[model samples]
Target: MSTVKRWTVDVLVNDDEGRTYAEACLHSGEADTRLVGIGRAKLNPADRDIPEIGDELAAARALCDLGQRLLVEAANDIEAVTHEPVRLRR
Candidate 1:
């Protein structure tokens, strides 16, 4: 059998002292699968000011971290059920 579900993610950024912090929240619809991840980027005082660039970089980092974590959890679950190591596919 096959099924489909929808997941949602929201990212928010905060700026302080040339630093941008982004937090990503992922909701998997299931009660036990909510996840949150955070990432940070710093702007050099000598460089040109570009808020959008910083926001994009920070948000992308946060999402990548979140994806890594989710994959880890999935691997753990697979190992627990199968009693074997999981070699994640590339």
Candidate 2:
């Protein structure tokens, strides 16, 4: 037998003044857990005014941080079951 699970990640991006901020939220139905990650991108003085680029960068960084947090959470769960320290790698 096999089991199938569903997970969802929502990313919201906002731009203010020359800076972009992103928040990534992860929802796991199986675990009933929620995790959030935040990221920001600042426009360099010499850079051009491209809002899309900043949004992309900020969202990517936020997702990356969310992934790391998920890994750590998984490691903690495993350690709890095994009674030993565990490290998870991407």
Candidate 3:
């Protein structure tokens, strides 16, 4: 029988839509500066072996980028709230 391994990762990601966004990021690297997970987003078992080559960047960059996006989004949201712009439906 095959064994399953699970890891615990703590990422300071914004309250995103849910795992959908995260999974999308995992699949496509075209994630915008939106809600993201930052810091120690994940914890891999010491015994587990991770591949060297990958479509994703290093964990450090990944987390930082996520964090940055979250910050940017927050700033923009705050601006919108302060400005209180009105929208018109076309």
Candidate 4:
């Protein structure tokens, strides 16, 4: 028999600059792909096929990567303002 699973995904950020962001998500109607499954808080890849965890973490990773790029861009801006070397070594 086939099985359907549910998952919850959450994102959180709390910075020292008095800023906070948080989100929670529930995903349903998800089928066992013979490639993936669901845990209490994450959608994980199936053990026989993929065996990794965290769609949520994967999304967070992409966001963090973009954030790092933006941070470097901001630093480059500051360097331009101060005539400093923009060593953007991404």
Q: Please tell me which predicted candidate would have the highest TM-score against the true structure.
A: 2
Clashes of each: 0, 0, 3, 0
Best by lDDT: 2
- Tens digits of per-residue lDDT, candidate 1, 36-87, equal 8888889988999898888888998999989888888889989999999998
Better of 1 and 2 by lDDT: 2
Tens-place lDDT per residue, model 3, 8-81, is: 33432322211111211222124332243533222244433333211132445555665566556666677788
State candidate 4's TM-score.
0.36
Model 1 spans > 4 angstroms off: none
lDDT-better candidate, 1 vs 3: 1
> Considering TM-score, which of the candidate structures 1 and 2 is the better prediction for this target?
2
Q: What are the TM-scores, per candidate, against the unseen true structure?
A: 0.89, 0.93, 0.34, 0.36
After TM-score superposition, the amount by which residue 28's alpha carbon in candidate 1 deviates from its true location, in angstroms, is 0.4
lDDT of each: 0.88, 0.94, 0.39, 0.42
> How well does model 2 score by local distance difference test?
0.94
Give model 1's TM-score versus the native structure. Answer: 0.89
Model 3: how far residue 69 lies from native, Å: 0.2
lDDT by residue for model 2 (1-86), tens = 99999999999999999999999999999778999988899999899999999999999999999999989999998999999999
Rank ordering of all candidates by lDDT, starting from the highest: 2, 1, 4, 3
Model 4 — which ten-residue stretch has the worst lDDT? 32-41
Residue pairs with backbone atoms closer than 3 Å in model 2 (clashes): none
TM-score of 3: 0.34
